[model samples]
Target: MEERRRYRRLPIKLELEINSLFKQNNDIIKLNNKTIEVIDISKNGIGIMCSDNFPVNYYFNAKIEFDEERYFYCVVKIIRSSKQGNKYCLGCEFVGLADFLADKVDEYEELLNKSQIY
Candidate 1:
């Protein structure tokens, strides 16, 4: 299959906490606190693996903590989902992310590549 993604995913792991979920019409869905694993990320989106059952096209708000001082909060829409053993792997697109942040993702990837050369 041909790769259709506009940006390449960086194989980085981060823990994200699902703060809320919403439908396309902006109706919120209440749920207990759940932590999920972010498997990969790009400028436009991220791939996550979690046990929480999220239907495709639904939007969820999550906070990704890069470190002690850096935290990013965003809304992501589920584009694809598949069962992986006991968990579900979801492909999602970030909604309304700022351009500078997207550029930061690209810069992070460049820095990672440079580190591996040493």
Candidate 2:
């Protein structure tokens, strides 16, 4: 596939909860506060590996905490999904992220580049 992404993806492992997941018709799927690993993140979206498969175009709410008091919340739209061994890898795009959150993501990407964190 051609490289078409406008934003560069930063490889970072973070634990987050999929607070809510909804189907195309808005039916909620119960996940029981499952903790999922965020494999990578970018200004546009994030990649997560989970035990379940996510339908493309479906939406979900995710909460990633940097610390006990600070966290980032966003509604994500699943763009692509694939199976990796026993787990499913999902690629999602932010529905509409606030400027502050977007800035934070950009800053994180910069830091990753500076420190060569991958």
Q: Which predicted model would earn the best TM-score?
A: 1
> TM-scores across all candidates?
0.85, 0.84
State each model's CA lDDT, in order. Answer: 0.81, 0.81
Candidate 2: tens digits of C-alpha lDDT, residues 10-108? 887797777667877868877778777898888898989999886788888877554454468888899999999999999999988987887778777
Clashes of 2: 0
Clashes of each: 0, 0
Clashes by residue pair, model 2: none
Q: Candidate 1 residues 1-118, lDDT tens each?
A: 9999799988877887776778979787776777889988888999999997688888988665555654577788999999999999999999998887677676667767987831
Where model 2 places Cα greater than 4 Å from the true spot, the runs are 66-70
